[model samples]
Target: MTAPHDVPDLTGSGEYLVPDVLQPGLTLVLVGTAPSGISARARAYYANPENKFWRTLHAVGLTPRQLVPQEYATLPQYGLGLTDVAKRHSGVDAALPGEAWRPDELRRKVEHYRPRIVAFTSKRGASETLGVPTGKLPYGPQPQPLDWPAETELWVLPSTSPLGHNHFRLEPWQALGDRVRELRGAAEAGNPSPETPVL
Candidate 1:
């Protein structure tokens, strides 16, 4: 794992707009379908100012303060990280080729990193990873771990994209923060938080 102060190389194929910000021991990892066109050009995740990813993180108390998209690399310090299902491409989910959704790659990363929680920023991401239709995914913790290791949990959150504005709700994000806090509290108390919800 890269040290917190060391800049980890996130670069990949030319198709990759922005490199993935990932490492081991993350408390949470947010997966998206792909980068927005603007984000691709800007070399940042959720670079569009309109995207709610950064704002929601702060609002949910997941971060100490609101962070701009350019600050993504600093996430690991707070036990948070970012990645996408389609690392070799950038565009809206509907425009991407079916093969672009590489769930196995995501699984390998999660298994290697072993984060406490893995949350999909959009149902499409979760569906692609879990091999289920988006309609079947509910917002918040998922009961099944899919192919994830038993030590990790899964969560599905509504898309923060402007296109998903109709379904946007902050409740699930807040719940996620609460669960993280619960896990931290349990760990600090030297008790196992086995039943902590993935939400």
Candidate 2:
């Protein structure tokens, strides 16, 4: 069946937050496949009460130790920017069937933003987007670099969402935060990463 081409109502969905561009000091551009209802309503990424994104990022040190969702906008100040492949929201990613996978858009963003690292927040998103078999993927660092423009680095991160948990726990997220801070620091130094990093 041809799905209806209707824009989902975001009036109460969490807000969609995209920085004017990407933050300059970004060694990491945290890109999700899209937003969910809670995040749309909260106007923040992973705003669902159970979603552990900010908590994980903070735990990892990518964010400045804050617990409130409203503070999410400030992540760019720390050299992290937020975005998504699909701007619309569905309660679950599986519901977003046939959502166009635009690697070109991703590539364009990489070229434009020039972040040191581009991390995909969910393995499902990365797997679906890149067409990699689920079994062959690695933990933490990806086997190969991201195929984005301008030679951006890529890393596949374990998703912080409760639903996205393939395995592991909060400890790994803390490590991600530290990695983000390190890359942000590196980008600030002008020695950008050689590969497109996705998490």
Candidate 3:
């Protein structure tokens, strides 16, 4: 969703964050907690130099080469998209106010786009949207929950933030790439609804 009408458009004024990269038939959509302060200023997702999101995506073969955050607009060319549960906010999770989160809006976007997969870039984001405790959510493909559309799969990936240093691992991301590849193959074979293996 674009910023509310009342809120000034940051992109056009060179002061707002980059608009979300989303559309139908996307192979994957990466949802983060919110844009970091650096990202907001730079108008890019995962813009912080310390954030490993872009590197991880390249390492996992999701991108042809490592992309700088500034190149986020090119994500859809690779069948990928970017968004967040908190659209109008930009900061660390702890600093965000209660109104920052809009899970219902996220659900609406996901359902409307019907991407093949919706992967949360952090457990905190997944938990907030799924209404489950972070401790209960595992890293990788989630079971087909009632709240999500059956055509769209859900995944919880480790956060690439510097703050998540203790929990950072590239294995789960590589696994996500594999799943996307599998899904793409299935779709090419006229089996777009192949059941995703729960992880």
Among the numbered candidates, top lDDT falls to: 3
Could you give me the TM-score of model 2 versus the true structure? 0.74
- Model 2: per-residue lDDT, tens digit, 1-199? 1112222222223443332225444667787877677776666667777777777776666766855666766766777776676665446777776654544555555666677667778776677656786576664556544555434556667777778666746654555566665665566688754332344
- What is the Cα-based lDDT of residue 187 in candidate 3? 78
TM-score of each: 0.90, 0.74, 0.90
lDDT of 3 by residue, 1-199 (tens): 3334433331234433558788678999999998999998888889889999999999999999999999998999999999888878899998999988878878877767789899999999998898999999989999877967777889999999998978998988999999888888887899756667665
Q: Who is ahead in TM-score, 1 or 2? A: 1
Query: After superposing candidate 3, which stretches have Cα over 4 Å from the reference?
Result: 1-16
Work out how many backbone clashes candidate 2 has. 30
| Candidate 2, residue 134: how far the Cα is off, in Å | 2.7
* Over 4 Å off, model 2: 1-21, 143-147, 184-199
RMSD of 1: 3.9
